[model samples]
Target chain A: MSLSTVAGARLVARKDLRIEQHSRVALAQMLPFGMLVLILFAFALDPSRDVLTRATAGLFWMTVLFTSTLAVQRAFAVEVDDGALDSIRLSGISAASVFLGKVSALVIQLLVLEAVLALGVAILYNTDFGGWAMLVAVTLLSTIGMSAAGATYGVLVSRLRHSSTLLPLLLLPLLAPVLIAATKGSEVALGQEAGQSWSWVALLAVFAISYLVLGVVLYRPLLEET
Target chain B: MTTTFAPKIIGTSSPATRILGVLSIIGLIALVVFGLVISPADFELGETIRILYMHVPTVSVAYLAFIITGVGSVIYLWKRSEFWDLLAASAAEIGVLFFGLTIFNGMMWGKITWGVFWRWEPRLVTTTVLFITYIGYLVVRSIPTDTRTRGTVSAVIGIMAIVNIPITHKAVDWWRGLHQSSTIFATVDPDMRGTQLFSAYLGLTVFLVIFAWLLIHRFRVAWLSERARGIGLDEAIAARRAEGSFS
Candidate 1:
């Protein structure tokens, strides 16, 4: 019998997160890498200029975008190595499930990373957060949008020979709207810019929803290629 | 195996293509005349009105090509046909070229009119995003892979990437609050009389013909390369056999 989408999603997610829990890749590597990036921004733009404080939202999201590429690369690496994806295929689960599973796991991991990054931004960039409602809304939508798009493109490039180098090239341009929306919305949230942040949040919702739909519909074909 | 090793005629030209070429050339001459000498300068835009003749059509054709690419991607996925795949890839290649022209012409328009080559305006950002999306598409297409895999992955991308144009436009619009006077066509030239309208229409028609001509050529080249690869595989095997069993 073909596994139900929900069941398959659960199984795959559990498998991935369980593997992550054992390996500590995200905790040990991604979190610190994200923090180092936060610190490096300080080095790149001297803190005395107070540019980081004024530009906190942009730097924070830009850092997330960079580290998320690494996260996506690592997420796909596990399946592509050692014939694991092939076994998953033979088990009669849907590709959509695998896509959803990977995206969910990436979402959780990235949320954790973003949380730490938010803290880093608070401490290092000296950002004072306000507009709590829009802040939470934009963060949630942006993460989902990033994770869904990343997962879709992630599986597409996973099996390629130069996939490590190729994934960002394929994924980053697709995520431009998210970056713009998230940055602008977060700027409003952080009291750096003044405007209708909800409209930007709406754009993020539209982006996240469309990518989620596209990811579900297109995952089968992408997985077959893999 | 005894075989005819003669090189296959891979010429993409034909009677139809020749007709397209001739029509395109004729249209282009007319477009130039209408754009430069025939059409009067606008009350507001002056000589800068001429750039719109090229700019508007290129942007229109770029969007048209991308829409076609999206449709082709959908059909390719549904039918699993190489023809649709080739059509999608061809349209995308042409779309990228047109978008490049659009961006360049747009920059000229912006600099002359607004005193800057680039701005954070909605159209500019949206255009650049679409351009970059297809650049990624073209880059991924260049990587060696099985035909089906390449087609499948590219089809998936083509389907989703098109959604970005609207999302980007909206995001930038919301972010920037879209000043009405800042735009080119909307505020200016809402109503064109006589020769001005004619020239605008003429430019659009000519560029469309040019786009069709380019699309046909690009599709033929992609199809030809695939055939050439197949023929090359046989030749490589034959040459290996002639080397006396791995000599």
Candidate 2:
């Protein structure tokens, strides 16, 4: 008997995580690249003034957005390089399982990267911790939303030669809503603004769920084409 | 694949499209005359509001073109027809053209009205995002792939991109309103009367006809090109076969 979709998803996710843990390329390379983006933003803007502190939430989210692209690229690269994708497809796992597995793996990797970048933002930008729980919640929700969209598009473009360049062009515009909602939510969570952050969180949740369902429904056709 | 004859490009244009082409030209002349000379200047915006005739209609048609693209994409995905895919691709090219025009005109209007070339206004930001998204859609089409794969991938992107439009609009509105509450621009309401309304209507009708005309011609061109490419591929394979190459 074939594995259940949920079980297959877990199996795929575990396998991806194991590979990532062994490679460590994402941790060693992408984390510092994200940090470099944050540091460069300070210089490009005004480091001496309080602008970086004021824009910490927006800047931090931008860093995460850029870094998540790397994680997504690496996720598909591994599967494509060794022809593992074809093996996985022929293994009787549902397309939805494969999609969810890739998304989950990307999200975990991004969360780790975000943690490191968050610490960097705290130290460099001097962002005070306010409404810490809300901050974490916003981060988690937006990260899921971003990773879901990213992973879906990543697979969609993986076969193309110019996928690395094309992925961001396709993804960034689609994720504009997520970026806006997350930035606003983080602003409120950081006490920079006075308002309910839950609405933004709700929007992020809706985006995340919508893309996840879309990926599930569409992945079968997408996989067949490959 | 068996080689097929290229379809006649002009055969795609029906009598209705020819009428539309003439009507669109007439309407264009009327719009220019009415907008530049006939419509009275707004009390607040003075002459700058004239840009609205061109700006508003281009954006309206741009939205229409994109909606058509989304519809074509859905139909293509369902029916797996090359005609629908070509239609979608044609409409997207026209949509991108209109989108570019809208942004350019908006920037000009912004400079005259707000004393700046650009701002993070919700509509402007949303249009910019839409522009980038569709441009990416076009770029995806340019990738070297089989026709079916290209059609499938672009159809997926086209549909997904349209779905994001409303979300982007809402998010930008919320983001801008929250951060820039104090910088709101108060101007004449878009509700117009007399010559202003007439010119706006004229512009919209003209642009809509232009879009239809361009779409038909573009679809024909795309079909012919695909046919030519297929013939070329068949010839290449025949030449290789004659050379005693066997797989």
Candidate 3:
């Protein structure tokens, strides 16, 4: 909550975003890959309009969940080279700042992915969007939880030689709660089901807050580790 | 001098452990007898309740094991001790084993009682996810790396994985609640009388003892392997040096 912490977080987030901007991995690669996954789902499922329409919410977040792994890997992938993380550590920013920073970068990239996937869902599935405000809230809350949880696991496996494979195995199960809340919340937001979307959003908020807090507290121990 | 003929201890064992092993064996037999024969069928659940006798114990012990793993991981992070690292790793291994058994027994019980091997119930899903998370912890431990690095990573996972358990459970619970009544799994009703109660309690005690026995042995194995790895590397280095000098 210190201004310094916020400033440090912004610094790291900007750095990651800058790297991302130059590389265009999120925009060029992940966005296309995410859309392709949506396209693939249409093939896997009954490409018929009704089924795809019902499944849009789940599939969108599921795509987000899958690609968040890539984003996280890239987020920490930047740090794995030439002891960049070590330099960052020696730079005197709090570990929480570094963690928040990474999560922030992840959230931005996933939001972009989600935005495109949302359009893909609308177009390919012939779906209509309703509850715009609720949908945006769900997207923000769910993306925060997903990114925080992803970043936490991301750094834990960052240095392993087999990290690319190991990261998803370790991460996906932990993301179960976030996926459930997000998918369900999106379902309600899309009017595929009745009742309160906010309730599910509140559930997502719980997940978001829990992982954010977890990331902050646990990041220091892992950040200091080799 | 004549060499004395002494039997080699080929495994992690000693006099105390032997006695502990024997006690668990006896307790297991008692449980089997009570659970299979002496215990009467519940009016509601009937003979199927016997599976509960096994199912409850394994899952409970698994929970206990992971709790130890969590605690061990925390202390290791704090104290940087090898004992806690080995203990955490050992407990997680046993926890995975017992959780596997729990699932197997649970599936069998479900097949018999509900005519289905699996259901998308909250408890079932939560248990599966918990199992996988610890499996991840074990995989992290197994990754080839420096001892401190491996321990540090595993410890972080051990801490984080346990924190996710309750959250996973709650999420699944509400996830289920959204659609239907959350009957997920049944608990042993307190109205049980006589041998049924005795068998249930016996099953729990016996399983706890078995878990302790497995944990102690597993810890010894992990500790030995680490020591052996260190010594093996040194000997290899020494041998290569001698070969170089001779050449």
Where is model 3 chain B poorest over a 10-residue stretch in terms of lDDT?
B178-187
Per-prediction DockQ comes to 0.77, 0.76, 0.73
Q: For candidate 2, what is the interface RMSD?
A: 1.0
Question: Candidates 1 and 3: which is better by lDDT?
Answer: 1
Candidate 1 local lDDT, B64-177, one digit each (tens)? 999998999999999999999999999999999999998998899889988999877678777888898899888878889899999998888898888877887777667667
lDDT of 1 at A118: 93
- lDDT, candidate 1, equals 0.87
Prediction 3 TM-score vs. true: 0.93
Candidate 3 chain A: minimum summed lDDT over ten consecutive residues — where?
A1-10
Residue-level lDDT for B206 in candidate 3: 94
Off by over 4 Å in 3: A1-3, B1-11, B178-184, B241-247
Put down candidate 2 lDDT per residue, A1-226, tens digits, no spaces: 7888889899889999999889998888999899999989988999674999899988999898999888888999998888899999999999999998988888888989988888899899998878888888888888888888887888889987788899999998999899889989999988899777898888888888888887887777677775
Residue A154 deviation, candidate 1, in Å? 0.6
Score residue A58 of candidate 2 by CA lDDT. Answer: 89
lDDT of 2 at B78: 85
Q: By lDDT, highest first, what's the ranking?
A: 1, 3, 2
Question: Could you tell which candidate, 1 or 2, scores higher by TM-score?
Answer: 1
Tell me the deviation in Å of residue B152 in model 2. 1.3
Q: Candidate 2, DockQ to 2 decimals?
A: 0.76
